[model samples]
Target: MRAVIQRARDAKVTVQGEVVGEIRDGFVILLGVTHDDTIEDAEYLANKIVHLRVFEDENEKMNLSLKDVGGDILSISQFTLYGDTRKGRRPNFMQAARPEQANTLYEQFNNLIKNEGINIATGEFGAMMDVTLTNVGPVTLILDSKEK
Candidate 1:
């Protein structure tokens, strides 16, 4: 499992010109699943992301977690994160998990976040979504469960 986490002032996902998910003052999380990803991976990332202290404190230090700031999450399933660009003109998606497996893990991940008591909005799984966000501080981070 992997994720691209971006702090945002606001974020939303649209599908076929209809808003699917939206949030304010939180994170826009682009999540990806690989063939070997498991529930443990989803759990690890959910715990880490919600508790991550990247938001600013009263003194302007990056010391507040998402919970501290009452932030929301706009979660989106992104299979292309695993696209392999090494030896071909076209990106290879061999490392991405199959749709069924990916969607299962993706839902589990979102449930874990919701269980943490943080409000979470999500893009439709397996859909062509248009996501927009105002990235606060332009702060972005990448996390891979396998790396941890």
Candidate 2:
């Protein structure tokens, strides 16, 4: 599993000209799943993102977790994160999981984060989505279960 986490002042997802999910003062997560990903991978990434201390504290130090600042999340399924372009111009998506499996892990990851008492809004899985966000501090982080 891999996740690109962006600190957002506000974020929203739209499908077919209608809003699907949105959040304020939280994270905009582009989550990806691989063929080998399991519940463990989902759990690891979710925990890391939620506890990540990128938000600034009163002293202007980046030391506050999402929980500390009472933030929400806009989670989106993004299999394209596994796009591999080492060879040709077209990227290969062979590493990405099948939709059935990927969606399961994706849902599991979201449920885990929500279980932590943080509010979560999600884009429709496998749908063509338009996402917009005000990236606060321009703070972005990438988390990969394999990196651990």
The C-alpha lDDT values of all candidates are 0.98, 0.96
Q: Which stretches of model 2 miss by more than 4 angstroms?
A: none
lDDT per residue for candidate 2 within 58-104, as digits (tens), equals: 99999999999999999999999999999989999999999999999
Candidate with maximal lDDT: 1
Residue ranges of candidate 1 with Cα displaced over 4 Å: none
Per-residue lDDT tens digits of candidate 1, residues 1-148?
9999999999999999999999999999999999999999999999999999999999999999999999999999999999999986999999999999999999999999999999999999999999999999989999999998
Candidate 1 least-lDDT 10 residues: 83-92
- Give all candidate RMSDs, comma-separated: 0.5, 0.5
Q: In model 1, state the lDDT of residue 135.
A: 96
Candidate 2 residue pairs that clash: none
Predicted structure 2: clash tally: 0
